[model samples]
Target chain A: MGDPGRDEPLAELADDLRRMVVETLCHAQAGHPGGSLSAAEILAALFFSVMRIDPRHPDWEARDRFILSKGHAAPVYYAALARRGFFPEEMLQTYDELDSLLQGHPDMRCPGVDMTSGSLGQGLSVGLGMALGLRLKAIDARVFVVLGDGELQEGQVWEAAMAAPKFGLDSLVAIIDDNQIQLMGDTATIMPVEPIAEKWLAFNWNVLEVDGHDPAAIVAACAAAQAVRGRPTVILAHTVKGKGVSFMENTHKWHSALVTEDLKEKALTELCVREVR
Target chain B: MVEMVAMRDAYGQALVDLGDRDARVVAVDADLASSSKMDLFAEAFPERFFQIGIAEANMTGIAAGLAVMGFIPFTSTFASFATCRAADQIRVSIAQPNLTVVIGGAYGGVLAGKTGKSHQAIEDMAIMRAMPNMTVLAPGDGVEVRKAVFAVADHDGPVYLRMSRDPSPVVFDDSCEFKIGRAVLVREGRDVTVITTGIMLGRAVEAAELLAARGISVHLLHVHTVKPLDVAAVAAAAEKTGLVVTAEEHNIIGGLGGAVAEALGEHRPTPMKRVGVADVYSESAPNDDLLQKYGLTAGHIAQAARSLMERRAAHAQP
Candidate 1:
């Protein structure tokens, strides 16, 4: 409806994020790769095309807020923030280092981070608070929260899901990274969260299932979320666990494994090939 | 003995006042609205109040959402559920982001009486105090509770306001002003300094008066706000009298006693005695009987103070 072609810049942004994620993980030598790589496209689209935010003024009163509920995917978020000029891109290398602002998880102490998150199932609630706070202040800023599919096992997430619509937090958007693999193993083998979209709808949210890798579809779904007026929106993004990396893709082992030099090079080559195409 | 008022009642009255002053202030309760005395707020501002059912975690998460949206949300429930059931959410979701969420944990310690240990929140102070950027307040009475509520509203960041479910006597009058991180010296003495918080402050006040009649002048410092502790006041009181006695209605391990010891251990080391529930689950009994059984009464505090004085005298003689 709005502009189907608005997704043109998203693909480039996602590619850029993938490269950044790989580079940062290589530099940090200790970070989550699988989930971060899986979430790059979604983060890129949300930051570059979907959300209305100002990089210069990270705490702008009227700016939209994004909460990475699955905080282990900090690499992608840090990449997007650095790219957006929220901080120096060079600082991305110091992620998880002592006294580094780029913490292993998103810390609110860092600029551009609306709420400190990483402990799963909690971010949506905090994002809900921010969205509600904006509405109470009569500020027209929307809140977008990204949650992991595996993290849904946390009972608190369901609690937040039930509450969002009750408050009429229409400005709140929850994006679930429905990556099949979790930390232990396949999510189905560990704890199944199938029928995800139906669950969200049951909780009174406006549910939309989309191809997470398809930047165009994500942008469109996000636009639909913005257009909705009463209930909160949930985008059940169907994504691969280790999206970009050839060896890492669709594997739970890479969820948070250290990226060896060989693995890094291989991952970079795969991302580059994806970029060139 | 001085009259006392329960801090929970003050919280309810303050909620009503806050709702009247600011429309953005809302109360969310998980089926404890009436018990927490939030019915008045709900009755007055039906539109602003939210009955969140029996979901403590959900209530906390929703409150975080409400706070983020620029509304001051006060979530009420039993201390056990408020802290234990939703501790992670409170820590990461609210405190980490530094949202303006006030968690009113009623029925802390043996205040739940017949409900027994399952409902008691002996570990709440420890859990909340461990959190970063959290303001932990344990107001002494109704007047102090009002001050603490207002103080929390003014102070930015997350706050855990521990209140009592039982009806406590009114200690402070309307003239009392609550200041964050400042310990109020209710009863001043010279022999020993007694630092007390929560409902136990009333007991400490009575103990201090009793000690005064027996020529033992005991200084009573009511520490309403636990975290962002009144270090200077506590240190100053400890400095004046080398003997210190800390009293609270919680476990001695991580509650007010432990907090005081930790502070005094770093600042000015003094011979101290802690008056609180020892490490043991409370059994079913009447409120007064439970207080006596758990060593949370005025008599227990006075006895602990006397023993500390004796120990101080013995150390001085040697």
Candidate 2:
């Protein structure tokens, strides 16, 4: 499909995003790298290709909004923002340090973070609010919320899902990163969320399915979400827990584990070699 | 005597006025719009009103999101649900970020005892006050509620407005100045200073008159803002009278009594007594009966004041 990531225009940006995530995690030595690695292509697609944002004016009222619902994946989010010029890329080295703007979770003080989010099952509802606010003010903009598959276990997510469609918030889009793994175990073993697309469809949402690692497919799904009207859209993005690094992929150990220097070097080499191939 | 009105009605009217004055002011409710008195604003600005059904946590997060977009969102629901059910949401979403959202907590205190313990919020103030960057307000009457709403709307950060369900005595007129973090001196005396907040202000006023008739003049202070308490006013009152009594419709453990005790214990350390619901669950009953059962009426406050003053006199003679 689309030359297996070679034809994707934002492929280089996605690769850079993954490298930054791994480096940031290795520097912090304490962060959730699995979800961050899994969400690289999605974050890259949104920040680099989909969102209509100006890095110079992070708080611009008219800019399209993006919220990291699965906020433990802050590494990927920070990488995309830094690459998009929301802040200096060099500042990525200070991630999770004392008094650093880059907190373990997404914070409003950061340059391009639309909403301060870390608690799961919260971003979709917040996005619904921003979408409603935009509609009331007559400001034309869309609100995007990225959710983790494991995060669906929280009941609040369903509450928001039941509300967005009722309000007819066509401008709100939720891209669920279905990594299928959680902190302690697999998502299905922890809490079965299969029939995920059917669940959203039952909630009256315009549902779409895509390969989360494919930036082109994710971009196309986002475009399809915009074409929808009178109902919110949700893209069920199938993904691997750790998409790039071979040892970390499909494993829950990397959900939040220390990244040793050796592992970091190995991970960087693998990511770099894939581009050349 | 002033006309009596429920504090919730004043809150509803304030929302309507705010909606008219500031287009950026929006309202969010959790299916209790009529009970929380947010229906007035909803009826006026139907477009700005967001009904989130019975989901308090989602409602709180939505309000936080709206605040992030530079909109002043007022989220309303029962005090018990708003503070307890969605406690974490308020802490992480609104307080940590310091957003400008006004949270209206209706049916506060044991006066809402008719709804049983599940609905009463005797610890709402304690929960809200413990949160950083939260401005807690328990306006004494309808007029104070109106003024406090307007004041908090103009305020730059998050606020929790605790209101009562039923109508109570009208304590102040439109001229009474209401400012956040400021305490109001209702009357002046050199005897025991009776400090009160929320619906207990009316009872405190009556208690002062009862003490005055018995040859003991009372200094009454209405502390509407529970957090960021007016320590200066409380200290001043205690210094003048040398005896203090704090009354409230909430649990004495962490409500107005607890707040006043903390203030005086750290600053003044004067002889004092707390008149409130003794740390116990309240039962559903008629308003006056429940108040009497919980030792929250005017007679109870006066008795507490008299006993504290007499105890001091006994020790003085010894």
Candidate with maximal TM-score: 2
What TM-score goes with each of the models?
0.93, 0.97
Docking class of 2: medium
- Give fnat for candidates 1, 2 and onward, in order: 0.80, 0.65
- Per residue, candidate 1 scores C-alpha lDDT tens digits across B1-318 of 546566677788898987888777888889998888888899998877777778888788878877766788999899889999999889777887788889989888887858878998888998999999998899888888887877777788899999887768788888987888888988777888999999888788788878878898988888988998999999989988888999988889887889889999999998889888788888878888888888988888899889988886787794
Whole-model lDDT, candidate 1? 0.85
Interface RMSD of each: 2.1, 0.8
Prediction RMSDs, each to the true structure: 3.0, 2.7
Off by over 4 Å in 2: A1-8
Which parts of model 1 are misplaced by more than 4 Å? A1-8, A227-229, B1-4, B312-318
Instruction: Give the local distance difference test score of model 2.
Output: 0.91
Where is the poorest 10-residue window by lDDT in model 1 chain A? A1-10
**Model number with the top DockQ:** 2
Q: What is the DockQ score, from 0 to 1, of model 1?
A: 0.60
TM-score of chain A of each: 0.95, 0.96
